[model samples]
Target: MEYKWVVLTNTTLGVIMSSMNMYIVLISLPAIFRGLGINPFLPGEFVYLLWVLMGYSIVMATVLVTFGRISDMYGRARVYTWGFVVFTIASIFLSLIPSNSGNAGALLMILLRIVQAIGGGLLMVNSTALLTDAFPPSERGKALGLNQASFIVGSFLGLILGGMLVGYDWHMVFIVNVPFAVAGALWSVLKLRRTPGTGVVRLDLAGNVTLAAGLLAISLGLTYALMPYGNSQMGWTNPWVIASFPLGALMFVLFVLSERRAPAPLFNLSLFRVRPFSYGSIALFLNSLGRGAIMFLVVIWLQGIWLPLHGYPWESTPFWAGVYMIPMLVGTVIMAPVGGMLTDRYGARLFATLGMVIMALSLLALTILPYDFNLFEFELILFVSGLGGGLFSAPNTTAIMNSLRPQDRAAGNGMRQTFSSMGSTISMALFFSMLVTFFTMYVPNEISSAVASYGLPAQVASFLSSIPASGLLFAAFLGVDPASAIPQSVLSALPHSVVELLDSRTFLPSIIGPPFMDALRISLYISVALVLVGALFSWMRGGKFVYEESAGRPGEGRS
Candidate 1:
C-alpha cells in the first residue's frame, strides 16, 4: 500500500476513536452514575455531573494549540503516534475504575478523562496537518472529507454504541475502545513516518502558560455559572464566577503581549492576515457554537418529554433517543464526502455558505415545532440539519488547511481546533443557562398546578413543587423518574392514587413540556442567528486558494 493511503487510514482511525470518546460517556451517563453509586440530583453531585460532561472538552480546548505547536517542533507523525498510546492507556484505566467508588470514583473518572482529552487534543491537532502533508492540494479535500466524516459519524455512533454497551456492562463502554486503540497505536507506530525538513525549535513557555491559564479560567467560569447562586437561577453573580472572567481576559492580554515578544510564538498571530484562514475559522467557531448543544437539547427533549408522552418507559428513553436520531447521521453520511469532492473541483465558499444557510433555516423551523411534534416532521428537520453539517464541515476544514504553509500547518490547524472546541464548551454553557433560567421561572408553578390538579393535598403539592428545577433537569437527562427522589416517608403517606400519578410516565413530562418547549424555542432562535452569521463569514472566505502553489508568487496568497 502507498504511504499516503497508510497515513489516511491511520489518521482516520485515530480521529474516529478520539471523537467517539467525546459522546460515548454522554449517552451512558445514567449507567455510569449507577456504577459509581452517585445520585445526580443532589446539589453537590451536580458539580460532579457537570465536570464529567465538560471536563474533556475544557481540557481539549485549552491544550490543542499547545500540542499543535509542539507537533510542529517535534514531528506531527511522531507526536500523533504517542497520542494513540496515551489515549489507549487512559481508556484502560477508565475501564478499571472500581465499581461503586462514590465521590472518589467520580473524581477519579474526571481526572482520567482529562488525561484522555490531552491525548485527544494531540490527535485532533495533528490529524489534518498529517493528511494535508500526505495528499496533494487537489486530493486534500477528499481525504479530509473522509477523515472529517469519521469524526461526525464517530460522535453520533458513540451514542448508539454507548447505549448498547452500557446495557451489558458500564465497563464495556470504555472497554470497547481498548482493542481499537491498541491496534491503531501499533499501526501508527509502524506505518507512519515523520515528514522531512521538519526540525526542532524552542518552545514558547511564556505564551503557552498565559494562553492555557486564560482558557482554563474562562472555561471554569462558564461551567460553574450553570450552578445556582445565592438566590439566582444561575451562578452568574458568584464571586468566583465574576472574578474568573476578568482574570481570564487579563491572561489573554498577557498571552498576546508575550507572543509578540517571543522568537517562536505558540500561535502565529500573523496567520489571521490570510482572509480564508481567518474567515473560515470564524465561521467554524460560530457554526460549532450554534450546533453544539442541539444534540443534548434533543436528547433531553426525547427523554424528558417526547418519549414519555408517547408512553415509553423512563428507563428505556436513553437508548431509544439514540435510535431515533439515526436520520441525522444518515443525512450527514450522504453529504459530507460529496460536498468535499465538489469543493475540490469548484471551491469551498459556495457549499460552505449554502450549508450554513440550510442549518439556519432548519434551526428556525425547529423553533416553531410544538412540544408534541410529529415524529416524522422532527426527523425531517434533523436530517436537513445533518445535511447542512455534512456540507459545511469538510470544505470549511479544507479551506483552513489549504491556506497555511507547510511549516504553519500544525499551528494553524491547532488554532482552528481550539476555536471549534471552545465554541462547543461555551455553547453548552449559554444554552443550558437559558434553559435553567426559564425552568426556575416557570417550572415551580407548572409542577404545583399539575400535581394539584391530580387532587394531591396542598402540602404535598408544595413539597413536590419545591424540588429544584436543576435536579429535575438532571433527572430527566439521566433517564430517571424524578419522583424516585422523593422521600420514602412522603410516598408512604400519600394516597395510592397520588403515588400512582407521581410514578406514571406521563405526569412529569406533561408538567415540564410547556416550559421546556418555551426554553427550547429561545435556544433555537439563538442557534438560527448564530448559523446565519456563520454563513456570512463562510461567504467571506472567497475563492479556491492553496498555499503551496502560491508560496513564492506575489499577491498569490489572497484568493
Candidate 2:
C-alpha cells in the first residue's frame, strides 16, 4: 500500500509539473520577450508569440490519444516514466536559450515549447490508465480527483510561480521544473509497478499519423490566425487559416474511418459504446473549453487591467498578479481531497452537478468585477470558483475512468484526455479571437487620439496606429512595457505627454474596457451554459463505477 502511494504520488507530481508549465508562459511572456530583446509588436512576430503560448497545448492535443493508445500496448508506467525523462531534458534545453536577438530566440523558444508539449502528451495520455491499474474502481475518483486537483492547482500555481520567478529572470520558468522532473523520474523508476495489459497490440501507424497531422494543421492555422491580416487587428481572413480548415477536417474524417478499419486501432471506437464514459467525456470537454479559455483571459484581465491600474509597476505586475490569484489556488487545494473522498462514497453526479452550478455562479460573479476592482471582492469569488472546479473535477473523472472495462481502461482514458486536450486548445483560439476582435472595435480611436494628443507629427500617429491594436493589447496583456514593444525611434520622437499617455495603465484599459467587458461577459454566459450542460451529462453517468470482470475491488492496491 505504501509502495503504491509512492507510485501515485510521483506520477501525479510529474503530471502536475507537465501541466503547470502549460500556462506559466503566459504570465512570463513579458519577461521572456524583454529578455530576448524582441519587439513583440512586429506583425510577423505576432504569429510566433501566439504559437509560443499555444504550442504546448496544440502538441498535447494532437498526440495525447496516440500516446495513450501506445501506452496501453507497451506499459502505462513505462510511457509515463519516459515522459518525465523527456520533459526534464526538454526543460534543460528550454532553459539554455540565451538572449539572442531577432527570430533565433523566438524560434528556439517555440520549438522547445513544442518538444515540451510532446512530453506533456506522453504524461497525460497514460495518466488515467496508470491510476486505473493502481487503484480500485471505487477509489479511482478520489485518486483521479487528487490528480485532477494537481492539474488545476498546477495551472493556477504556474501563473503565480511564473510571476515570482520571471521578475528575477525569464529562464526561471523553465529551470524550476528541473528539480521536480528529476524527483518525479527517480521516484517513478523505483516506485511504479507495471500493470500488464491484454491483447495483441499492433501500432496504428496510419491512424496516429493522420490524427496528428490534422490536429497540427488546425493548431498552426489557429496560431497564425491571431496575427494581423492587412489592416485587420486579427487574421481571420488569412488564406492559410481558411484553407487549413477543410484540409484538417478532411484528414480528421479520414482518421475516424482509419480508426474504424484498423485491426488494432489507436483510438478504440468501442469505448464510446459505454454510456457513462461517453457522456462524462463530453461534459469534461465542454467544461474544459469554457474553463481553459477563462484562465488565460482572466490573467490578461488582471495583469493588463486590474494590476496595473491598481498602481503596480509593469515588472511588478507578474508577481503581484500571481499573488492576488492565491485565493483560487488555495481554494482548489482545500476542496480537492474532500471532493474526491465524497465522490468515492456518494458517486460523482451530485457533486459534479453542484460543482458546475457553483462554477456558473462564479463566472457570473466575475462579470461584475471592475477593471480596477477591489481585491477582497474579486478574491472571494475566485476562491469560490476554484472550489467549485475542484468539486467537479474529481467526481467527473472518477465516473469516466470507472465506466470502461479494465482491458479498455487505457483507451477510454486516452479518449477522455483527447477530448480534454481539444477543449484547452480550442479555448486559446476562441478566446484570443474574441479578445482581438474586441481590440479592433475598441482600441484604435483611443490609440489614435492618444498618439495625436501628444503633439506628434501626422506621419508618426499614422505609423503608431498602423502597428495594430492587437499587438498593443498583447503587449499590455502580457505586462510588457509599452516602450520596449514599440520602436525606440518612435518613442523618442513622440511628445512626452503622448508617450506617458500611451504608457499609462488608464489609457489602455479604458479603451479596452468596454469591448473587453463585452467579450468577457459573453464568454462568461457561455461558461455558465457549459457547466450546466456538463452537470446534466454528469448526472446521466449512472450510479456507480460498476466493473464487470475487473482486476480487483475498489481500493485494492491503493494506499
Candidate 3:
C-alpha cells in the first residue's frame, strides 16, 4: 500500500480538531459556568462539567468501533465527510448558546455538547482507519506516531488556547471551530477518496445499541458518582452509582454474547485473536490511563493551589495554568517522532518499555514534590513524562493497527480508540475518587484543627465542615480560592477568624497539601503499575508490522 502525505495531513487535521474540541471546553469551563451564572463548584454542578468534558469522549468511545465498522462498509470518506459537517453544526449551536446564566441554559449547552460529541465520534472513529489504509505497514508506525503526536499537540495547545480564548469570551471556545471544521469538511468533499468495505455482511444494530448503552451507562454512573452523597464525600455509594455500574457491566457481557453471534459485529472480537494487537491495545489503554488524570491534577495544582499562591488571581488562573504547562509541549515536540523512528530500527519493546519506566519515574517525581514546588524541577518532570507518553503512544498505536487484517482496520482502530478513551475517562474518575476519598477522610479534621489553630470557635469550625466537601473540592479543581467559590451564606456562618483563615492562600494550601499529596501518591502508584504493565505488553507486541494479504501485494511490512 502506498501512503500519501495528503492523507496524513487530512487525518492529522481530523485528530487535531477532535482533540482540540476535547480540552477547549476544559479551560473554558469555569468561564462558561460563570457566564451561565452557575457556581461551578456547587453541588451537582460538577455533573454538568464532567459531561461537557467527558460527553464527547463517551460518545466517541461508545460509537467509535460501530462508526469504524460502518465506515468500512459505507466508504470511510463518506462517514468522514458527514462527521465534519455534523461537528461544525454542533459547534455553531454551542457558540450561540441560547443561555448559560440559568439552569435551562446550562442544560441546553450540555445537550448541544453531546451533539458535538457525536460528530467528533464520527471523525475520530474513521480517521485512524483512513490513515492506516493510506500508509504502508512498515511506515505505519511513523505515520501513526506523527498522528498521535499531532493529537496530543492539539490537546496541549487546546489547554493554553482555550484558557486564553475563554478568558476573553467563553463563546469563543466553541466559535473557534467554525473555520477549521468548514475547511476540513470542504476539503474532504473535494479531495478524500472513497475506499469501500469488502464484506457483504449485515450491520449489527442491536449489538451496537447494546454496547453503546452499556458504555454510556457506565459513564453516566461514574460521572454522577462524583457528586456528594448525604454527609459522605462522594456519591459512589449512591443508588445510581451502584445500579448503573452493574447494569452497564451486565449489558457489556450481553454485548459480548451478541457479538459472537453477529455476522457483522460492531467490534470484531476476532481482532483480539492476534497477540500483538490485543496486548498492544492493553498497553495503549494503560498509556492513556496513566496520563489522563495528570492534566486535571496538574491544572488543579496550578490554578487552584500553586499559581494562586504565587499571586495570579482566580480569574486568570486558567491562562496562567496553561503557561505553566508549556514544559509538556517541549518534551513531546522533541521525543514523539524520535521515539517512533527509534521503534522503527530497534523494535518496539525496549524503547516503549523504557518510555513507561520514564513515565513511572516521573509520576514518582510528582508524588514527592511539595504543594508549592519549584518551577524548573516540576517542568522538567512534566516534559519527561510527555516525552515518555509521546514515545509510547505512536509506536504502540502503529503496532496495534498493523497487527490487524486490512479488512479489520476500522474495527481495530475503533477498539484501540475505545480502550484509550475508556482509560482516560476511567482515569479521571479514579483520580477524582481517590482525591475525594482522601479529602473526605482527612480534610475535615485537618481543616477543623487548622481553624482551631487560628483560634476559631468549635461551632464555626464544624459549620465550615458541614458545607459540602465538593465546594472546596471544585474550588481546588477550578483553581479558585475556596473563599471565592463559597456561598455568601456559608461565609456568613463561619466565624470571622475562620473565613479569614479559609481565604488565605497559605491556609488552603497548608491544610490541603498533605491530604491531596496522599491521594496523589496512590494515583502515582496506580499510574506506575499501569505504565510498567503496559511496557510489558508493548514488548510482547513483537516483530515488525506484518501486512495482511488483503493489503494488496505491495503492503510494506518492514522498514
Candidate 4:
C-alpha cells in the first residue's frame, strides 16, 4: 500500500474502534448492570445509566472544536498518534475494573469514558484534516466515504458484538478492543509522520472554556431529563434541568463574544461567510437531529415489544434485534462510496437534498405501520432510511470541508462535529420527552386495568397505577421481564395462577404495546418534520463548489 493508504487505514481503524465502543456499551448496558449488581430501574440507577450512555458523547462533542484548534496549532499527526495511546489505556482500565465497587465502579467507568472521548475527539478532529492533506480535492470525498462507511458499519457491528459478548460476560465487550487499539497505536507510531501545523498559532483560552462548559451543562441536563424526577415522569421540571438551559445559553453568548474579541479566534466565524459551508452545516445539523436517535428508538421497539411478542426470550432479544438490523448496515455500506464518488464528479447539492427527502418519506412510512408489521417490510424501510443517511453524510461533509481553506479545515471540521454532536444530544432529549409525554397520559390507566383484571387487590392495583410510565418504558428498554421486576412481597402474596399469568411474556407487551406505539408515532412524526426542513436547507445550498477552484471558479459565490 502507498503511504497515503497507510494513513487512511490506520485512521479508519481508529474511527471504527471509537464508534464501536459507543454502541457496544449501549447494547451491553443490561449485562453491565447485572454484573455490577445494580437494577437500572431503581431511582438512582437510572441516573447512572444515563451518565454511562451520554457522558462520552458529551465529552467528545465539547472537546472536538478545541482539540481541532489545538491540532491546527501543533500538528495533526502528533495529536492523532497520541489519541491511540490514550484510547488504548482507557480501554484497559475499563476492562479491568474491580467487580465489587458498585456505584463507585459506575462513576469510575464514566470518568474513564470521558478520557476515551478526549482521545476519540482528537482522532476525529484530525482524521479528516489529515485525509484532506494526503489526497487531492477530487479524491477527498472518496476517502471520506470509505472512512465514514467504516464508522457506520462499526456502530452496527458493535450492537452484534455487545449482544454476543454480554451473553457470556460483560467484560468481554471492553476486552475485545484491546488488541485492535494496541495494534493501531503501534502502527500509528511507526508508520505515521507529522504534518506541519499552521505557523504562529495563539491559544483561545476563553473560547475553549466557555464553549466547553456551556455544551457540557446543556447535554448533561438533557440527558438527566430522561430520568424521572420526584413527582414528574420526566425530569424537565427539576431545578437543575431548568437551570441548565439559561446557563448554557448565557455561556454560549459569552463564547461568541470572546471569539469575536480574540486576536485569532478559536472558531473563525469568517468561514460561515461561505454559502455552501453555512447551508451545508444547517442541513447537517437538522439531518442529524432527525436521525440521531432512530437507532435507540428501534432498539427499544425490538427489545421491548416486537421480539418478545414474536416468541424470542427476554435474554435473547438484544442479540436478535442486532441481527434484524443488519439490513440497515448493508444499505449504508452500499450507498456511502457511491454517493461520495458521484459528489466528486457532479455536485453534492442534489445527492444531499434527495437523500434527506428519502429519509423523511421513510419516517412517514414507519409511522403508518402496524405495531406488529411484517418483518420484511420493516427491514426494507430501515434499509431505505440507512441508505438515505449514508448518501447524505459523505457528500454533505465533503461540501463543508471543500469550502474551507487548507489551514482552516481542522477547525472547520471541528465546528461541523460540534453541530452534529449538539443535534444528537438534542435529538435524544426530544425523543425521550415525547415518549414520556404520551406514555404518561395513556399508560398508567392501561396498567391499572390490566393488573386489576388479574385479580389483584385495589391497593396493589393503585401502586401499579402510580408507577411512572418512564419506569415502565425503561423496564422495557432494558429487556427486563416486567413481572420479575415487580416487588417480591406482592408476588408472594398473589395466587400461583395469578403469578404465572403475570410472569408470562404475553402480559407486559400486550398491556404496554399500545401506549408505546402511540408515543413512538409521535416521535417519528417529529423526525419527519425535522428532516424535511433539512432537505429545504440542503436544496438551497445551490451548485457545485470546491476550494481548489476558489481563485478562478465558475460558482465562486457558492464557495
lDDT comparison, 3 vs 4, better candidate: 4
What is each predicted model's overall lDDT from 0 to 1?
A: 0.82, 0.75, 0.75, 0.80
Q: Order candidates by lDDT, high to low.
A: 1, 4, 2, 3
> Which parts of model 1 are misplaced by more than 4 Å?
196-199, 231-233, 553-559
The total of clashing pairs for model 2 equals 0
Worst 10 residues of 3 by lDDT: 550-559
Tens-digit lDDT track for model 4 on 1-559? 7888988898888878887887788777767766776654565465676667567767766678878878876788888877888888888889887765688888998898888888888888988888877777788789889988998878886889988988887888888777777888888878888767676577788877898788777776776676678876667789998999899999999999998899878777888788788899999899878877767887778877888788888777768887887787778888888888888888899998988998899989889877777899999998998899889888998888888777777888998888888788677766766777678789878877786677666655665566667766667666665556668897788778877776667777777888888888888888899999999999998788888644553224343
Backbone clash pairs in model 1 (N, Cα, C under 3 Å; residues 3+ apart or in different chains), count: 0
Which candidate has the top score in lDDT?
Answer: 1
Separately for all candidates shown, the number of backbone clashes (residues 3 or more apart, or on different chains) is: 0, 0, 4, 0
lDDT comparing candidate 4 with the true structure = 0.80
What TM-score, computed on C-alpha atoms, does each candidate reach? Answer: 0.95, 0.91, 0.91, 0.94
- Model 1 C-alpha RMSD to native: 2.1
Clashes of 3: 4
The alpha-carbon lDDT assigned to residue 334 of candidate 4 equals 82
lDDT of 3 by residue, 190-299 (tens): 77887655545577887878877887788777767767877765788899889998899998998899989888777777667676678888888887788777777877
